[model samples]
Target chain A: MTAEFWNGTMAAAAAAKQARVQVNAAYPITPQTHTVEYLSRFVNDGELDARLCKVESEHSALSACAGAAAVGARAFTASCSQGLALMSEVMYFTSGMRFPVVMAVANRTLSVPVNIWADHQDTLVNRDAGWIQIYTQTVQEIYDLILLAFRIAEHEDVCLPALVAYDGFILSHASEPVHPLDQAAVDAFLPPPGSADRPLLDPARPLQFGEVLFPDWYPDFELKKHRALADSLGTIRKAFEEFEAASGRRYAPVDAFATDGAEMVIVGLGSMMKTARHTAEKLREDGVRVGTAALRVFRPFPAEDLLEAVGGCRTVLVLDRDIGYGTGGMVYPDVTRILYHEDHRPDVLNFIVGTGGKDITPATIERCVELARGGYRGRVEFWPDARGAEEGVPYTEEPAAP
Target chain B: MPNTHPESASASAGRKLHEIRLAGRGGQGVVTAGDLLGKAAVREGFWAQSIPTFGPERRGALSSATLRMGPEEILLKCSTAAPGVLLVLDPTIWTQFNVTAGLVEEAVLVFNTTEAPEEVEARLRGGALPYRLGVERCRICTVDATGIALAVLGRAITNTAMMGAFCGATGLLGLEPVEAVLAERFGKRASPNIEAARAARDAIRWRA
Candidate 1:
């Protein structure tokens, strides 16, 4: 198999083609426009048999995808920061109805100042939408996970929508060598769209998808949705296992790197995992017991896997790209929720870095680990130095000493 | 650095394509240099990849680009440490950052400066460094590119002139193939840029 280096934009389009999408709907935005442009080319060249729906807004894009998927057609769409927010209302419907639509969210900073760099605040803001979210760290993973997302979302036990996200401009524009599967192999791997047993608009069996429920049935419906989401955990793992067996590239909900007998651990999502791994290697060489874990699957939370991975560690640092306003960070609260139930939880620390594509280097990771090990117990600590503001001076401030 | 021997016909057949690094202040055509090299490599029937590293503050800050080429495919995506060729568009970058910290022992260093090669070599003593051309040639090429861009595309983009210098220095790909690529890349304005690129190719002088 000949290896070809593809820019992330091209790789994404190639993956979409491999998924054999029946429809593609998107709105143009910076850093993400390139991917859609490639999709347009693919559609025009007949490489992909799909309807390229040029919508006026991201809301209509996802809505069109939902409508298509509800009618038993495989559907795909993509969006970023403001676009994601614009589609927030329909985003919940897609997941609640269990449409099995896959979306590639180019992660970007949500705005007031109108920034277009990479960040997780956009996707993280949609956490309660009931969508299964998977964050990718590299261009290769971006290609691989799109295929996996379709399978995972369509699984009978996990009939839920899925979002595969990667940092905009960071991974989306970065070029790297990726091994693209042949068309035959991809066709063999993804079977043709199986009969959607639960179609929204079946003439023979009419059912209400998003009906206004009375007070009595509304709580039960919501509980059922929660139960369905919880049941998806098993299906998610099985899909990952099958993908690994076929492709020979293994992926897990939570990936731990160099965490053997480590006293301290750092947890992050998206591209920061790469920085963390590099930092972990450097720290291990210097004889510091530090390890890094990246949560590939954010929704369905993977509570058990996360607890098992961080168990017995003296300290655990939770770094989140999104902040929950006055309450530290988003992942920090979730990690604490899981730790609260455990009999023995490691000293959980939360640090916010890489917000709005602030440069997070290996040295910043090292500094984060040092702070966590030094008994810093504040709710949230920000790595201002990681922005490369002050040079040549190290550890200038004490970080409020708590 | 000196050319020990003329490049063999098949020298680059299996020897992985050389990795080149270009460093300069923002808006100095550093990224353009990498893009031109990539386009030319692709035209020569080789795979190429280019990436830019820029800071938040867009202008006047240090920006760099890396270009990799090879027969099979290029995979090393990070910044090149030991680049085989280093093109410095701004001399100030040498002091502002450690741009020349790592270079292959036999690597050639090209700079846009009026300083004597001896002075440049003295500053880069730990490793062998050679100054091949000055900013005068680059400014001339830039002026030509602006004229071509304005006349052809109604916008002055300096990337074409950098493409010309790359073609002149390396002889990696003929001007005809580059022009074809430029035509495919920039449809309506290919003719003027092709002429500008030819002028740039003719203007460059590689000093030993």
Candidate 2:
């Protein structure tokens, strides 16, 4: 196989082209603009036989995808932070309508200070948006998961939309060597758009969709959608297994590293897990039994697999890039609730870190491990209390002109 | 603190991880230099990653890119803080930025300047440069990359020339892979950049 250097955006666009997405509608946003730009280039070069929809706003982007998917077309879109916030309403509509529209979200922080940096706030805020959410740790995973997302979202058992998230700038802008899957392999692994046995809004059939249900009927439909999302875990695992067999790259919902009989395991998401895992290896050299468990799939929650990864450890240090105001962190509560009734539960500590695009250095992670090992517990704390202090790049103001 | 790199540190031998920071203005192709180096390293069967500093890059404003290359997969996704090599595309960058911040001891410095090592050191000594210990010990490689670019490409883009200097001074990457990467990226326009790189590589002056 020929390996090429591709950043996360190029990988996502390549996967979409390979998946044969017929309609792509997206609005331009920082970081995420590159994905759609690459797709447009593919379309212009006649490499991808797809129609690029030039939408004006993020809401219209998803609306256009929903329209295309309602009629048995494989539709795709990409967005981030504020753009995702704009598409929040359509996100719910697209999921509830069961259109199976797959979106690639370059996870970035929200505004107020108006920053464009990597964080999980954008995707984490959409945790309850009724879509299957997955996170990626590397550029290769970005490509693999995008292809897998199309298959899982289009699976007959799970006709729900999905979001493939990678850290905004960390993975999005960073270039790495990725051995791309062959087009024929991807074609064999993923079926065409209309191949699934689902109802399509054909002009000959004239079926109605997105009709408002009465109060009593609304609850049943909502419950069914929720169950379909929860039950889609089976479909996700099956797709992962098949993709692994076809490509020889193994993936799990909770990708664990060095978690065998460890005293402390750091739980994190996105690109920071790479640094955390490296730190764990270095700590192992220093006789510290620290491991890392990254949550690849966040929406279905993957509680059982997460527990299995960290159940044997003495302490679980949860790193959350997005804070939940008074509650501290978004992932910490879910982790605590999952281990609440387990027989072998580890002490969990939450650290609100990397908020507003702060760098999560190895030193920052090492500090967290030390705290957990030193019996610091039962409280959510902020890391690197002094900004940019963990990394010793001293700030020096330019001297006044002589 | 965890060891950033827990391997040996020899330029020509062993499985060592090299971290390089390319500092330049936005219009000077700093990010593209890192990109070419990374792609070349990957082509030579080494694990490589390069990322531009995240922000809105305005022309004439300060911009930088970081590159990491090793014999195995690189797990750290963050930018390199303690780089073993620093490439300065604009000599004026030394005034506005530290330029040598977090550099490892006895590191390598590649400059896009026409001055010799003595002249460059005299200038820095005259200025108020903080943390002079590491800067004093670093081995310096001087090449007029901008002059080479101007002479070869008729433009002020120094990325290709800087890439050549990096390959020449470090011997970490061969010229064949770098030429292949340039030909693939620039297509028919690759001839001038390749010429500029070859000139800069041969013209580099090194001092311990």
Q: What are the TM-scores, per candidate, against the unseen true structure?
A: 0.77, 0.94
Name the lDDT value of residue A158 in candidate 2: 94
Alpha-carbon deviation at A22 in model 2, angstroms: 0.4
Can you give the lDDT of residue A361 in candidate 2? Answer: 68
* Reference-based lDDT, residue B103, model 2: 82
Pairs with steric clashes in candidate 2: none
For residues A248-343, could you state the per-residue lDDT of candidate 2 as single tens digits? 999899989999889998897898898999999999999999999999998888888898889889889889988786677798888999988998
Q: Per-residue lDDT for A164-235 in model 1, tens only?
A: 998887677766567788787787677686455666677787877877889988899899888887778888
How far is A364's C-alpha from truth in model 1 (Å)?
1.4
- Relative to the true structure, candidate 1 reaches a TM of 0.77
DockQ of each: 0.14, 0.44
Query: What is the iRMS for every candidate structure?
Result: 9.2, 6.0
